[model samples]
Target: MTEQRPTLADVARVAGVSRAAASRAINGTYGASEAVRRRVREVAAELGFEPHAVARALATGRGSAGRRERIEILIVDPDPEAMSAKPFYGRVLNGAMRALGDQDIALEVRRVSALPVDDTDPPFGRVLINVPGAAGAAYARRGRTVALGRSAPGVAFVAPDNDDGGRQAAVHLVATGRRRVGAVFGPATPCANERKAGFLRVMSGAGRAVASADGDFTRARAYMATRELLEREPDLDAVFASCDVTAMGVLRALRETGRRVADDVAVVGFDGSALAEAADLSSVYMPVEDEAESAIRCLLDPARPAPARLPTRLAVRGSS
Candidate 1:
C-alpha cells in the first residue's frame, strides 16, 4: 500500500512552528522573517512538503485572484491558424472548452504562427504543441512548461496511443489473412508514431513486413503515399493510414491500384473523423471528445496518476 502524502500542517507540526508562520515562510511573502523562512524550508524539505497552488490559495487567497485567464493553452506550431477549418482540432477545442467551463479556470487559446511573441501579451502557465518544437517551449517562464505532442512528465497532452493503434491495426489485418500490409501516417505527431508502431506490430504478427513511407494527414498525399506503398509491396492486401484524412488519399490509391477493395487491399484509418461517415472509410473511431475531456482532467489533476489510455473502436466499412 502507498503512504499518504504530507501536508503543510504536517511540516509545521514537525518544524515546531505555527501554520501561519509556515505559510508565510513557504510563500516567502508578507510576514515571515529570514530565520523563520530558513527553518520552515529545512522542515519542509525534511517532511517533503511540495507547495501546492490549491493549498497555498486557500491559505493566501491566491485562487481567488480573479479569473483573468490564469490557465492558457498556447499552441506552438508552424502550421497556419486554420483551426476553424480542421475538424480534428475543433472537436478537441470543444472538449477542452467544456472542461475549462467546469473547472472555472480562465482559458486562453493562442497560436504562435508568428515568431517572437509580444512580451506585452500575458505569460502562459502552460504551453501546448502539436509537433515537437523546442523553440516554442523554450519561451515559457520557469513556473510553467512547454507541452509537446503528447503527455510527458510535468506536462499535459491529448494524444492517442499511436503505437498501440498501429499494432492493433496490424493484428487485425493479419488475423483477416492479409498477406501483405502497408501503412501511411500523419506528420510527426506522437499519435502518428504510436499508431504506426501498432500497425507494424500487427503486420509483423501476421507474418508480413511493412513498407514504410508517410504522408501529411491529407487526402492527396495519403492517396499518393498509398500508391507508392502498394507499388513497393504489390502483394499488399491491407493498408493502414494514421488518420482519416490520409485514408481519403488511400481510397484513391486503392481504387486506382487495380486491387479490389478488401479482396486485394483493405484500408483502415485512425481518428475516425467526419470522413468516416461522410465517405464510408474503414477506421478506428477514437473517442476524441473523451480525449479532450481527459486532457482537461489531466491538466486539472496534475497530482493524479497518469490517466489510462482513452478508448477507441473499430469502424468497418466498404474500404476495409
Candidate 2:
C-alpha cells in the first residue's frame, strides 16, 4: 500500500502551531512572526509537505474552474536575437525556473521592442528587465511587477551592487601599479552609470585620469570603441571593459595592435560570465541567478518585499 503524502495539517500538528498560522507562514502572508514562519517551514520540509495549487488558489480567492496562475517575464530589448545570444537572459530564466520548482505556476516570456507593453491580458505577476524604473513602475498599476534593477518607489526590484563592483575594479587595477588606464563605458543606463560613477570616484581619489569611449553593450560596438580608445590613448597600460562580452572586443583589439595581455596591458571585465572564464579574464561577479530567484519569490507572494540589491565581488583571473 502507498503511504499517504504529508498534508498541511500534518505540518501544523508537528510544528505545534495552528493550521491557520501554518498556512500564513507557508504562503508568506501577514500575521505570522519570523520565528513562527521559520519553524513551520522547517516542519513542513521535514514532512515533505507540498501545497496543492488548486487549494491554494481557492484559499486566496484566485481560483477558477480551468485557470492556473501565470507569471510573465517581459524583456524590453530592441534586438530580436537577444533571447538566444545574450547569456544574461539564459541565467535569468534558469534562476526563475529554480525558484518555481514543482509549482503549478505557468511561466511565459515575451520580448518587446519598447514599452509601455500593450498586452491587454495581464498575468498574475510580471518580471521586467531592461526597462527604465519609471517606465517599469507603470506596469505595477496593471499587475504585480518586479524590476530587475533599481526602480521607483512604487515598484519592487532586485539589483546588484554595481557601484561597489566598480569600486573594487578600480582598487584592483590601481593596486597592480597600473597608471595609464583606458575604459570602455556602457550605455547611459542606471546600473551602468552607477558603475562608471564608482570607478571614476576611486580613480579621481588616486589622481589618475581615465581615457574612455562609449559602448552600447554589444561586441561590435565595443570592438569599434576599443579601437577608438586605443587610437586616442596609445600608451594606455590597462583597460576596464563594461562587461565580459565587451572584453572580447578589447582583447581582439589589443591582439591586433600587438599588445600583450596582462604583461603589457592588463584587462578587466564585468559579469563574470562563461566568456570570462574561458578567456581567463578578471571580472566582477554579480549574483544574476540569485537576483532572478528573488524577483520570482516577490511575485509569488506580494507580501514579501523584493530584495533591494544583491552583492558583487571581484574575481581576479589571468587577464589582469
Candidate 3:
C-alpha cells in the first residue's frame, strides 16, 4: 500500500502555526504574515506535503460541480499599463471577459515581466500574451499553457490571420488604383512581421515598389516613420499601416503634408478598431474576441485542436 500523504495539520504542527496559517501559506492566500508563510512552507516541504491541485481548486471555489477551472491570462509585459492602453489589447481582454461571463470558470489577469524560477506549481492554467523569446518558452514548459498570440516552438496559440490581412490590405489598395505605395510596419513581433511580409509579397507581385518604414506599433512612432516615408517618396499614392493605432499617425502625417485622403493618397490600416472607424480608415477586421475565446478553450482542454488562426476581412471605408 502507498504511504499516507502528509496532511495540512501535520505541516501546521511542524511549523508551530495554526492550521489556518498553513492553508494560507500553502495556497499563497492573503492574511498570512511573511514569516509565518515562510515557516509553514518550509515545514510542509520537509514533511513531503504536496497540495493537491483539485483540493486547492475546491477550496478556492473553482472546483464545484457544474463549475469549471480557474484560468489566468498572463500579459507578459513589463509595462502592463502601456500595453493595455492600446485599443487592440484592450479589445482582446474585453472579448475574453465576455466569453467568461457567467461561465463555470473563473478568470484572472496577471502581468509579469519575466517568468519565475521556482518549482512551485501555478494555481491555474495560463493564457500567455505578448511574451516573447525565452520567457515565452519557459511559460510554455508549464503544463496547460496557451498563448493569445503566436509563441515559441511547441506552444499552442490562437491569433488572427495577420498575413492574410496584410494581403487583403494590399489587394484593396491595388484594386483601388493606388500605386507608388508606402507602408508603415510595426515592431519585430510575429504578427507585425507576418503582416509586413504579406504586404511586401503582394506589392512586389504587383510590380509596385514599396517605400517602407518601421514603427513600434504606436501613433507617435508611426507618425515619425510616415514623415520619413513621405519625404522619401513624395508621390506615394497609398499607405498601409500594420495596425489601426499606427494608421492614426499615418493619417495625421498625410494631413500635415497637405495630402487629400483617397484622392491624393489612400490609407489602409489593420485591427479594424474604433479608431479606424472614427477616422474612416479602411482596415483589416480581425476577430479578436473569437481568438480570446478559443485561447481559453485551448487552455482548458489541451486535447482540443489548437494553435488556431482566425479569419480576417477588409472593412472598406472613406480612407481607402
Candidate 4:
C-alpha cells in the first residue's frame, strides 16, 4: 500500500495550532510569531510535510508562470551623488547580499527622491533605507516593507540602539574630561532624533550643556555646521558627530581651524564605519551590517517579529 503523504493539517494538528496559523508559519508570513513558526516547522519536519511548490506560488500571488520573486531596495535620498560618497549604504548592501545567499530571490536597487504615491506594480517585498518614520507607514498599504531604521507604529523595522549609542558617546566624552561639548546633529529623522535625544539626556543628567548645529548627514554640511558651532562656542572641548561621514567633516573643520584633535578638542562620532577606523576617531559602533541582515531576514520570513534594537558600544580611539 502507498503511504499517504503527510499534510499541513497533520503538522498543524501535532503543533496544536489552527490550520491557518500552520499555513502562515510554513509560508513565512505575518500573523505567526517566532514560537509558532518554530513549532510548526518542527512538526512539519517530523511529519515529513512538504509544501507543494505550485500551491505556494499561488498562495504568495506569484504564479509558477509569473515573474520571478524580487525584493526591491528603495533608497530615499534626494541627492543621487551622495550614494557614492556614503559607506553606510555599501555596508547595508553587503549585509543584504550576505543574507540572500542561495535564496531564489532577486534584489533590485532604486533611488527615489520621495516616497511613491502610486500603487504601481509592487515587488514581492521592499527594504526601505533613509526613510522617515512617518513616511514608512504608507508603505504598509503597498506591500511587505521592512524599513532599516525606526518607523511609525505598525511598520516592521530593524535598527540599532541609536539612543544608547548616543548616551555612550556622551559618557565617554564626559569621562575623558571634556567640559564644553558641541554636537553636529543629523537630519530630523526618527533615528537621528533618537540619537540626539539620548545624547542630550545624558549631558543634561550630568549637568552639562551642549551647543549643537544641524547637518544634513553630509560631510560638506557637517563641515559648515562644525565651523559655525566653533564660531558660537570657540571653547568647545568635545564634539559629537552624528555619523562617521559627519565626523570626517568635523575633523576637517577642527584641523583647518588650528584645533588639534584629541589634544585640543576630543571628537566622537556614530555609525562606527570604516571611515572612523581609518581616521582613528573614537566612535559609537553600531552593527549596521548585522542590522541589514536582520532586516533582510524579516522580509524573507516575516512570521517572526523583528528585533526592536540591536546592541551598540563605544569604540574608544585617539579622537577622544
Q: Give the top-scoring candidate (TM-score).
A: 4
Could you give candidate 4's per-residue lDDT for residues 1-320 as a string of tens digits? 99999988898899999987788789885446789989999999988899999767765545757756788888988876766888888898889989888666778888888877775788878888887767777876677899998778989989999999999999988888889999999998878898999999999999899999998888999999999999999999999999999999999999999999989999999999899999999999999899988888888766667986999999999998
Instruction: Report the candidate with higher lDDT, 1 versus 4.
Output: 4
- Per-candidate TM-scores read 0.68, 0.80, 0.75, 0.83
Task: Give the root-mean-square deviation of each candidate in angstroms.
Answer: 9.2, 7.1, 10.1, 4.3
Off by over 4 Å in 4: 1-66
Which candidate number maximizes lDDT? 4
Clashing pairs in 3: 68-104
The runs of at least 3 residues in candidate 3 whose Cα sits more than 4 Å from the true structure, single-residue gaps closed, are 1-70, 77-84, 112-121
Candidate 1: list runs displaced more than 4 Å: 1-67, 76-85, 102-106, 112-120, 123-127, 131-141, 144-154, 256-259
Q: Lowest lDDT 10-mer window, candidate 4? A: 58-67
lDDT of 1 by residue, 197-253 (tens): 667665665567777677777676787888788777788777888887777778788
Worst 10 residues of 1 by lDDT: 139-148
Error (Å) of candidate 4 at residue 238 is: 0.7
- Model 1: residue 31 alpha-carbon error in angstroms: 24
TM-score of 4: 0.83
Global lDDT of model 2: 0.86
Clashing residue pairs, backbone N/CA/C < 3 A, model 4 = none
